[model samples]
Target: MAPKRMPKVYLVRHGETEWTINGRHTGTTDLPLTANGEAIMLKLGDKAAGPGKLIDPTLIGTVMVSPRLRAKRTFELIFSHSPVKPPMTIDERVREWTYGDYEGFYKHEAVAARKAKGLPSGEGGWDIWVDGCEGGESAQEMTDRADEVVRTVRDAHRKWYEDPERKEGDKGGDVLIVSHGHFSRCFLARWLALPLPAGQLFVLDPGGVCVGQYYHDLGKTALGAMNLGLI
Candidate 1:
């Protein structure tokens, strides 16, 4: 059999939470989705299915998500009407970065605190990707976690895609990863085997979906799209 083609991974940042709307670092806070967040999630399902870009609503594969209520609810709202229920799992590896000291603080306030101490902007002040929080993991640590999650997902999909006995339509794998904004960006970078600092290059908004594709023939990976289906 030919080498299996890995399926494209679709990552959706959970809908707007109170912290998200306020530009705060949420990271494992388990906040509920805002009213508008709910509305946008419903729209996302329709858009992904309506266009030929993603798997049809009836198609089945996997919908792994963070165990947090916000992430789980987003998955439920999006796939509520699908005829075929895909396998769902909660992978802690996909959870948001642990914000530690910065948790619950507004973005501006967080930046101000870093600046007060003469720290840099964008990513606290742990030195680029380093976690500036007093007690939380650094950016490099988050990158390590994200890398593990991507590796696990990639290995699983590779196995599924290589199952020769599977039918043609069943050959493809679709992963709906529901996670928080900052960590999602890190995951995207890891998916493309990019440097941890590269995560800052992408912005992941609530209810945004980023697609990454691995081109086997070309021996490379590409960010198919970013911040798609935003409302």
Candidate 2:
């Protein structure tokens, strides 16, 4: 069998929304990006997805986007000027963590509400990775969803690398994922084969981008870059 080729994956968290600015647990909410958010994303797209940039447009094999409008719009802005626009796939696995009853509530508000109801808030407070949202997905569930995306993208990468009809100098194998914050983190954790809770340690700001790739020639998965912002 031939050796597997190392393929890079880029995770882009959608730009700012009204709920994001208000610190609300935005899950399954379809809100458009603010004007400022759109502007920043455009700039980031130019910087990261432009020619001779970190995410070379010509090298992108697949683009996976969350079904939410916010995520979809972010993808639009980021690739608006790309010379080579890869086909996009709307994957539910990349959707934001479903907040359930906690949806639209700020973290502190959710904590206080849970306290009022005498619900256990864990050691410190309402840590989603620990407590998850009431009536929502557990950490394991999130991990499962993220794993689905990872598997799909990895398969795509393998197919791209092993394509016998691939043209010379094509270099097309990278996968790009445009999704939500918590979901993106979960995707990264799943990509690295780490525990779901480990995703809590990392923060992906609105409009931020992270890179995951195999190091040492596909011997080990590695995080090449994270929390990269245009502004």
Candidate 3:
């Protein structure tokens, strides 16, 4: 019962945008959700928020949202049912991995472009997690950013977990994040103390939800759920 009061982190991926639909690397470009994106987000709001849902509005202590319009819009949709707005941080740290020169290009296109430019596309070909975008962030940079996200989330959770009033019926709130697909995966990998490439091990769809909770105590974190579709 004491463990149940331990706060969890709710990871949410933004809904689809035009680039998302076309299989393009949408990084740094602020795009709004599509009509279908909005519809799906609305459906997700119904299933994800409120009582007995994966994200209980009243139980959200902090929200870390990407500065991108798509991610910000996703938060609005998810918590549309909330009685009061939760505290949020429009953190650039959770923003998508900027594609740089590969921006707006598909994975294959980026690979082909890299090959044409006489760049090392890796033996297996252009792996963003390994080689990274030509002019954008490197794997190490993303790792550091992901580390920051983990720390901030842990701090938010600590408040509820260590509260003196928690021994009673005080159920602490959870930390929420509304970010892009790749970034969220990376963040989760860092949360689990795994390498950045381990992010490729899991896939998170647009409007999907992932949950992480403390195991044993607040010191050890475990994946509660991943790639869960609300809509």
Candidate 4:
């Protein structure tokens, strides 16, 4: 068997929604993309997933999408123009972080509500990475789910790497994941074997695309690119 080659994973956040534009904690809320969001995603798809683009559609082997309408729609728009359409599977693990009581509340409002209820806030305020939303999933729980996703994808990649039919320099082993903002960040953190709180430092804007890949060794993963937008 040939030595395992590092594989790249593309993390894509869904297009803009009303709550996303308004900076609200949009968790478990199924919101559709706005007109502008759809337009932006169309352009992004052409630039990022088109031939000779950052994400070559032909090279994509696996596509995992969140079950949310916004995420599903974004994935559809992104590959609508591509010549190759990879099979897509809905993974509940890729869904957005559940905000529970903080749902529909803006950032400031969530912080204030937590304070009013005598809940402890991090030094930087009520960050979901630390405080996690009340009545929702804790950081540990989210980490567990995200880790499961990582394992699933990695297991598939390992099979591809071990396949004798695969040739060198073929990046077709890449995996594409379409999901929400916060959860995407968490997914990236877990991909690098970092703590969930470390996700707080990463930011994935609407319609943004980030790439993660193994470094010198297949066991070590690193961020290849992030916050890429359509030029």
Could you tell which candidate, 2 or 4, scores higher by lDDT?
4
- Expressed as tens digits, the lDDT of each residue in 1-231 for candidate 2 is 444457789899999999889888899878999998999899988887766787777788788888999998898888898886777789887899999888888888889988998999876768888787888888778888888888888787778767787545657788989999899888888788988888887789999999998777554778988878665
Number of backbone clashes in candidate 4:
0
Q: For candidate 3, lDDT tens digit of each residue in 1-231?
A: 434477889898999899888899999888999999998888888776765677876677787899999998888887687565676679888899988999898888998999999989876669988888889998898999999989988988887776666544454468888999889889989999999999998889988999988887889999999877653
Q: What lDDT is obtained when candidate 4 is compared to the true structure?
A: 0.85
Worst 10 residues of 2 by lDDT: 1-10
In model 2, what is the error at residue 17, expressed in angstroms? 1.1
Best by lDDT: 4
Tell me the whole-model lDDT of each prediction, alpha carbons only. Answer: 0.73, 0.84, 0.85, 0.85
Give RMSD (Å) of candidate 1 vs. truth: 3.2
**Pairs in steric clash, model 1:** 131-138, 131-139
Clashes counted in candidate 3 amount to 0
Tens digit of per-residue lDDT, candidate 1, span 1-231: 455445777888888888787777777677889999898888886666422436443333666689889999888877665554455689888888777877887766666777887766654434536544646778768878988888776776666666668656554465668888777878888888888878888998888888877765324667888888874
Off by over 4 Å in 3: 1-4, 167-171
Which candidate do you rate higher for TM-score, 2 or 4? 4
Runs of candidate 4 with Cα error greater than 4 angstroms are 1-5, 122-124, 167-171
Q: Using Cα atoms with residue i matched to residue i, what is each candidate's TM-score against the true structure?
A: 0.84, 0.91, 0.92, 0.92
**Model 2 CA deviation exceeding 4 Å by range:** 1-5, 164-166, 229-231
Report lDDT (Cα) of residue 128, candidate 1.
Answer: 30
